[model samples]
Target: MDADMYAEAIEYELLTQAIYKDILAREGVNTVNVQHNVSIVGRSGVEHQVDVYWEFKQAGITHRVLIECKNYASNLTLEKARNFFAVVHDIGNCVGIIVTKTGYQSGAAAFCKHYGLALKLLRKPTERDWEGRIREIHIKMTPRVPVSNETHPIVCCLCLRPASEDQEVRLKNSSEQNPNLVHASPSMRFLGKDGQPITEELRLWIPRQLNVLEREDGGPYKKSLELTDHYISANLGNGIELVQVIGVLIEYYVETLPSNEVVLNATETVSAILKDFESGEWEHVHSAK
Candidate 1:
């Protein structure tokens, strides 16, 4: 897998953990978060890092689950699961699991075939409609209002004082202008409430992962290209109404995605995400090398 795929793998694990925490645990099912790279002292006086160790209560029985995630690998064995479980078994009443990049070993399958005195095997499911996921992502990334120094200046919009240059500003066509457009102007500087000049870059860059998601799902609405693209892409395949979907995106992206780029890539990134939304194909744009 490439960098993009690697990122996806990392995100997948995190999502799985969230599912265990949010859905399973919230629904009253037994679940827990496993810490990665734990250290434990063995009978031999040697210490090793434990991949994941957590406790969950099932059937009024507290069970510690030690899990290892193998995002890039394909094969795992019953023997491996046995060792992991054994190591933790001496520590407490526990279960061991090894999540691999691919499918399992027949031996491991047989071992986990029984509960209490058994091992466990879990198979990752193939994706059905990725378009939906892409859309949800877009919604999360949707652009908010166009910011401005007057409406949303480097300094507080309420106060037109010098702000740190690091702040970003979203802007749209204004029928009237605010005489008090906030800025980092030296004259606006103050000692207490008035902040130092907004000396930072005004815009934040979008990450490649979100960029990929937008590329896939952005489109169809002819509204503000940026806002609509985010809405469409984010809502695709989710069965959510377009109005509600796009509204969320606008709120999110407006809150995030640089109003401009620090270097020169800002223009290109904005243009590209919008263009992809318009065209519904990220294929045309050249990815960052």
Candidate 2:
């Protein structure tokens, strides 16, 4: 039996892991584990799962990497090459790479031609390359960011609401780079619209809420409160009655300020800003997820 078919695919995957290990060393990272998997959003707004994801951290900045290895006997075909596209949005944010012994399908090659990254080709490892090859590539999880419990003026980075509630014991820090994700439904569309997504450039996980969405078009603000009336009137879909909005997430942002600080910072918080909507000194209610 020729060893290049099934046997070679396995061997190629092994070599890919070896290269990943050396990459960590080159990047000043210490951990390595193989067969890493990652699911991240692509430019197409669809989530893409990757074969190998490399991760590391230094001086508090975190890094995520995606690795693609091709072990085909012939030049890559369109379908196989299409695999190389794998729905990546920004390689700038990732340590993007491809490892192929036989190289990519023309389609895949053309896709990755730009973005300033070249696929790294791996030949048979020699004794010299063996020392450089890392036995494995495992990523380290980043530490949870530290937040304080003391209630201060906090703002919703996504919806831009100053009124936010602290879910855990501590109030999360806010930053501009942070984006929030919420499953789309009718009620959520209204909320996101009121949140001024275009101005904030907020990320919307909108998946057809099947409800009327109102937006303030500069010429008109949604004075009718049609959405509010709809949710309140229909009271539809399992415990979805509209409670009178006491306040919005903006207030919480205001309160989370360091007493002396007047202006609230607009940095988006990474964890999530949804849970903080409409928090007044209300008693906690347990809702089953």
Candidate 3:
């Protein structure tokens, strides 16, 4: 066979395999073994090449099914249908199906129907098939991200001093008799004066305070608010005793990210479209890749 012809034939066999596998799964035939490009010996001792084959045992009896795939640009004819019927008849006690890309002639359809052989069409979708169907979809995504413009200096209430840019204030949990030093952040689980975790309370209070500052300043501005009431003690590590935390600086604004449009096309994503010749029912098989 020509290289193009061989490639097309292999593609058709793979498409048939994908369609039948999904069909078998939907029909609840999990125990069946499906094979591609296999040969089975007929009752007359002649080995026949099968494009797709599956076998399963039901009630101790083995049932077999065979499929032939044709990658022809033209419609399948009566001769091809008769040849497939003969193969199925000689094989005996097995179901036969013919899958083609362009569909079958009227005579071929009649012949297959008379012999109880199945005929199907599987191919890439065309413009006509996409009528009233969504060919492509666009989705707009916008993200709101918090942007910090300025962070004010932390103030120690005992000595009435503010920390420098390179300085970090260590916060101590006052609920314990010997309070443990802990790093201060929005996610810290430090205890308040009431001996309850004030992390959640601080998260809510900080935003409210920032909003108040934004409203008062009418724009970007620096503001400080006490995080918790007498529960948090801070040390500047400058020989001063751990003093109560008066306030911490927080200033930020929310920036909306640029909107992005994502486009998804059905034709590019769909692997194949399987259509039954007789029933006219169809299904879109998406690529697993």
Candidate 4:
């Protein structure tokens, strides 16, 4: 593979490891190795490397699991599946898994099924598992223009106050050059009623959540029911206007707060905000996947 493909493959492997680790950890399996290299002695005395390995002891017996990540642009073919199955057969005493970024072809899937191997398509988790996990309060605000002469005038920020009554969490513009727009993943999209395209200069902001832990030194946890505000500034326009929200797509699940309220973690938030700045009624799709 080339440099880009190599890096992509590494990322896919890491993602797979994270996902499987999360799943296995919940199931009480504690041993999982990412990017693990294993040397298996072949019948001819030759050795081969296995990419990812996992093991757990159950009832005094150690059960081993092997995973191979393939980040290909197209579907995995039957030939590669056969090769992987051959490796598994040679290694012996393990559960084999093939994780593909795209998907597996029918022939390849059949090969894996015939050999008792698993095929998983690696993708972001859908929201079904996290729907009622957190408490949320939504508020809509427009960008305000200050009379003072500044490089960027209109300031629009989203302040979320969860039902927990925690401190207000603020999302402000993260870009110094733009001063009113924060970077967004999956990019925001808006459509007009005509089924055509409508464009508006918008800024992105990701909310932040805070956690409190008790100090081992005998200090209090200093717990707060409300969350602090992270700043995110956006310039929608010169005056107060309505932004009609249509839909929202979030990449990560909301986490439970100290007060038992659910909210988005600091590192990530809604990936795409679908709106027209007209009506506030928006559809929050928890599991469109």
Which of 2 and 4 is the better model by lDDT? Answer: 4
List candidate 4 stretches off by more than 4 Å.
31-35, 124-289
RMSD of each: 19.2, 24.6, 10.6, 22.1
**What ranges in model 1 sit over 4 Å off?**
1-16, 28-34, 42-48, 56-62, 114-289
Task: List where candidate 2 sits over 4 angstroms from the true fold.
Answer: 1-7, 32-47, 58-61, 90-92, 104-110, 125-289
lDDT for 59 (candidate 2): 75
Per-residue accuracy of model 1 over 88-136 as CA lDDT, tens digit each = 6566667655545454577665565453333222223223312443322
lDDT of 3 by residue, 169-204 (tens): 332223233333332445433345555555564445
Q: Candidate 2 on 140-218: residue-level lDDT in tens?
A: 4332211212443222222222222431111123222222321122234233323332211111322121121232111
- The better-scoring model by lDDT among 1 and 3 is 3
TM-score (C-alpha, index-matched) for candidate 1: 0.34
Q: Is candidate 2 or candidate 3 better by TM-score?
A: 3
| Quality of model 2 by C-alpha lDDT | 0.39
- For all candidates in order, the CA lDDT equals 0.38, 0.39, 0.68, 0.49
What shift in Å separates residue 239 of candidate 3 from its native position after superposition?
31
CA error at residue 161 for candidate 3, angstroms: 34
Cα-based lDDT at residue 60, candidate 3: 89
